[model samples]
Target: MTTIPVIDFQLHAVGKEGCVELDNLGSEMCQALEGIGFCYLKNHGISEEIINEAFRSSKDFFSQPVNEKEKFARSHNYNFGWVGLEVEKLNPERPVGDYKEAWNITLEDHSLEWPSEKVPNFKPSMQKLYEMCTDLSKRIFDVISVGLKLDVMNCEDQYVPATPIPGTIVVNIGDLMQRWTADKLKATKHRVLNPSNEQQRRQNRQSMAFFVHPDDKLMIECLDKSNKYEPISSIDYLNSRFKATY
Candidate 1:
């Protein structure tokens, strides 16, 4: 079995004073993020009920008939709406599509917006979850800035306006983090999965993903440590990865 590490952020939140030790908590987080691109964050301050609600709503949405879910597909923008089972191929080279279904939403300026009108109910639950995740994301970013010895608000501009939609788990790719960390940190890759088989599909299983992108025109580059880290073009990386897997 493959296991991903969960770094408890609550420890840092409550132990912020003690975390200044520099070598202990800071290094630990850096290492974990750089290696896995994803970590389970506990003590993140998002309520359990909110998380549960998002998941429950997602399941309900996916439970709908294929024709119903298709009404919400945003194949054009790749921003918001529903994605059917195996509709999104993450790895082309792998030649295997996942058996899953998902819905997406974005947050901007503390407001939520769905790309398509088909999923009307997406907004309410998405907004609730977005608020929680955005808040937690800000707190985590602050700690990361402090850990990197950068201004506490160094990464603030990146999150402002909070994107159009927000939530408990914000699915951001590795490209932005690579720029922010000068290639030292990675944006993790994750995909939604239909955990149950065909029979369960009738019952409906849905996953929600909230992906954050840098402003369209913004260019990300290496920071002060650019020389130390090898440069990888975000566009090329994404294209290559998608080609190989999807």
Candidate 2:
């Protein structure tokens, strides 16, 4: 099977006059994405220090008492806080709860209330990681957009993918993006697994997902260049997708 492949941004270092790098990297990326919708991205530009420190903060937060973490329980359609283990079933089509947990973050707006005092230094560190990853996501998306012949600048500015590979952060396509692309891109189902070894299980597994989305009212549909999908509201799609979880 063509499973999730490891891809790097070396293509980016090549000169623009030659499409070789872009051509090769773009084809490889598109194939893996179309096959599994997930990829291991290397040289994504997010520093090792950023990911390490962020994970440290995440582990500390999850280590807090259950009650404290619950304070950020997903409210309304805004999935912006801690999700307790067994609280979510990624594929509700099945009968089991996902063995993983996560914290969903989004853009910081006036409406984006920050529950300060919950975890010290959490906001500052997280905000830094958020901005870095957000920028990286767009760079990777630029490759995908070009591979598909879609103008990267005209495509959604922020993107989401998944998996944490030590120095590399994972990126994946989402339901909204899939629907918008008429499944031209896949929203692959993925999850983090608890360490099976006794020793490994003792160590905590903490991951953070920066779920970036376009403005709420933006109309979403397959682009005019590819009119395979019907129009839908961006915010509505995000809310509806999250409702299926848990």
Candidate 3:
């Protein structure tokens, strides 16, 4: 069975005492995030109802025949909209495609837009979840910064001007951390599974991933003074490895 480690949010919500404990947790969590690129975040402040509702809505949206889901398929950029099973390829180096169906939503400056007309109630439910999750992600990022002994807001820039991208839940990892960790920690690589597969389809499994990307125009490079590692362009790194096949 594939398992993602669960990091408890409560560990960091209570201030100093919490922060202290989380300092220890951060080491383990960062190691997991670096090695696996995915982890199960338990005790996340978001309500179970919200998580279930988001998943339920996603399942309903993907359950519609392919034609219907395609209506909202991302256009222009590879970022937003509905991605069908075997439609998004994650690793260009690997020939096989990913197996999954997903509905992606993203926010910037706390603003969100969803295809409500097509997926009734999708906009509101997702917006609510995004707000909550964003807050949670920020807290986690802070803990990571402290764990690494960098300034409190050292990692803040990566998430400040959020841009949308796919994966089941929101993901943040980019040039900033690459520079900070000297390539020791890497941004996560995640993909949705094609819902058409018998086992997955039978279980009605569908995923929603929200990736918080840096502003499209932003040029991410390692800081010179912090030159603990070789600098690399974020876009080049992402493009070289990620080729969405669904």
How does each model score on lDDT? 0.54, 0.68, 0.57
TM-score, model 1 to reference: 0.63
Candidate numbers sorted by TM-score from highest down: 2, 3, 1
1 versus 2: better lDDT goes to = 2
Write the residue-wise lDDT of candidate 1 on 140-232 in tens digits.
Answer: 665555555321111211221212223223323266576656655656555434436778767644344444444544444556654545555
- Say which prediction, candidate 2 or candidate 3, comes out ahead on TM-score: 2
TM-score of each: 0.63, 0.77, 0.65
**Candidate 3, residues 65-162: lDDT per residue as tens digits?**
88877777865455567767667666677576566666665443234345567678776677778777667667777766655533222221222222
- Candidate 3, residue 21: Cα displacement in angstroms equals 7.6
Candidate 2 lDDT tens digits, 135-193 = 76666676877676342322232334444466555667887877676676677666455
User: How good is model 2 by TM-score?
Assistant: 0.77
In model 3, where is the ten-residue run with the lowest total lDDT?
Answer: 152-161
The alpha-carbon deviation from the true structure for residue 192 of candidate 3, after best TM-score superposition, in angstroms, is 7.7
- Candidate topping lDDT: 2
Q: For model 3, what is the alpha-carbon lDDT of residue 55?
A: 72
Model 2 off-target regions past 4 Å? Answer: 10-23, 109-118, 149-164, 224-228
